[model samples]
Target: MIIDNGKLNKQQRKAVETTEGPVLVLSGAGTGKTRVITDRIVYILENNLAQPWQILTLTFTNKAAYKISKEISISDTSFKILNSKELWMGTFHSICLRILRRNFEHIGLKQNFLIFGEDDQKSVLKHVITNLGLDIKEYNPFVWVDKISFEKDKGIQDKYSNKELNFDKIYTAYNAQLARLNGLDFGDLIIKVLELFQIAPDILEKYQKQFKYIMVDEFQDTNAAQMQLLQKLTGNNFNICCVGDDDQSIYS
Candidate 1:
């Protein structure tokens, strides 16, 4: 199958054609960053580098994932075998949820475990704060929820510190409550998957071998947990392409 390069400029063409090793495409707004990503996938497919399922495409938001999926689906009519649904593509939390669901047993969780939303997490935190004999007015559940989430995003667990309140006790109790209810918050999703990979080397090997190529969109916005997850998956095969503008980074 002959791939078309008429729409791409020199840099975009290079980003699409470089399928071997790690490739990083830094671009600003309206510079065809998304186009480069979609076209790169097409180039890999048309060249017979990997099957549709072997390419792991990840984005930071569900909207971005949907856009990428839609672009790949309608990008070329000749590539009938290229079904975007078959590709492992989704947001970081969504992808982690998929991994955790399949390997729930390895992480001491049921297959039907619940994912707690913000309100549910706040409720759990409130209960923990009250049970610990702390005043909810002073130790606000809402504030604690954000605090815990920030720490988890940094890959820290049970070791958080603060001068004002006994956050360590609260963090421990909050996690214990979550485990009792067989639930995981959004932050737990990424860390739990990381935990699963650490305990189950065979499972990690299975995915590492399965995903021949990995592509990350908005790579500048990835947090520590997300970065670790990417590192673990790409440890064996480093065929990854990350496209993002450092100036557009939201994380400072």
Candidate 2:
């Protein structure tokens, strides 16, 4: 038996009951967005529209993911939803990390690979510059590093024609160093996962089949790369629901 918390209004209830392809719920703050999401999970399970393991829920932050998990546990008294191993819920990067760990062999990544932060990333760039025998002042570590990051985010390799410094050489060396260390920076988390999906169709198909339903919170905040990932995930099932408010979206 499913229980309705009676906290959602008519419109929110409509969203919860919806069972279709590519749903978008746009609403302002204090409108029980999170409540509706949890209720929607219950609705899908109660109606047998999807199994717990077949549903994938992604939040932008760990806090949002935790809140959803807590709410589901509270709302579902039997704890069947909470105890299900098939259920997948986490931040986007964390989810990608889990996938990478399981299928790292296919993507040529170590299962125990480390993720480097900004400081570590800068350190790697510095090493690359030093190894190339270039002076740090002329090369400008911070400026070049920022450019490289921008290029990575855009999913393209950028070139610069500064007579004294070679951006391409620096970029190539930086990537090689990262590969040697078996590490990935924050941006590569999503980029490499997307690359895996493109290069390995069978693996991508497995996940597409595993997750029959996908829910994304803070959709408006999603950048181009994130949107591409969502597109690929939902291509087969088209059972995606994004909940966010345009007005509240701080990220472009």
Candidate 3:
């Protein structure tokens, strides 16, 4: 648990040491933000604040997740005392997928439900559009995919009532098609987890109690759905840390 304080600047040292409550560290590019996150994790482990499985670290991309996981694994040789692989660390979608895989049946989805990629989702949308007697040229599946994703991210439940394009009809039909195939698009990963939590408070409570500490990288890029998911998981225990820079936010 011995850390050489000389290696870390005063601010980084403080971030690494302060592990009791919600902490926010805002830093610009190349300021060693990742190092701070990994070191903080190391600090928690070294101090036995929480077990590896009780810690959840999330990033936006698979690459970033892998990078952080690897950094934590190599941060200190003492990390060998616990299996870092047991840590709940991954991209938002990947983490959600894990949760959904376990409790999807609660949301009326089978355990083996398929997860459709963008191309597969578009194909399904195209089929729905054609079956609804809409012109493919007029209702571009690509555009609709983005529109649907945007709506889902915002947690919009009401069907589109606008008559100009029958967006409501298309939206419903598209979802129906996905259900008929027992599949879900990328957007459904986060949305369905949120839905599962809402319908099953007991299940949500289990996770809230399980994950004692949570950390999010690239917090500025999180959408509404992602924010809600974080809120629910951290509702019971507010021990969380977020590191991001407003200037580097691409989603905003």
Per TM-score, the best of the predicted structures is 1
Clashes of each: 0, 1, 0
Q: Locate the minimum summed-lDDT window of 10 residues in model 2.
A: 156-165
- Per-residue accuracy of model 1 over 109-226 as CA lDDT, tens digit each: 9769999999999999999999999999999999999998987897634455454558878988999999999999999999998899989999999999999999999999999889
Kindly list the per-residue Cα lDDT of model 2 for residues 1-252, writing each as its tens digit: 234547668878887877687788998887777677777887888778888888899888989888877777766454466663457888888888888888777767776898988788888988899899999887777777677766566542233333334777897799889888999877777778888988998888999888988998887777666777787787778888889988987764
- How do all models score by TM-score? 0.95, 0.88, 0.93
What lDDT tens digits, residue by residue, belong to model 3 across residues 1-252? Answer: 334658889998998888878899999988977777788777888889988888899988888878877776655546574466888989888999999999988999976999998899899989999999999899999998988888778653444424445887888899888988999988899989999999999999999988998999888888888998998899968889898988988875
Backbone clashes counted, model 2: 1
TM-score of 1: 0.95
List per-prediction Cα lDDT, in the order shown: 0.87, 0.78, 0.84
**Residue 192 lDDT (model 1):** 94
Model 1 scores a C-alpha lDDT of 0.87
Ranking by TM-score: 1, 3, 2
Report how far residue 25 has shifted in candidate 1, in Å: 1.1
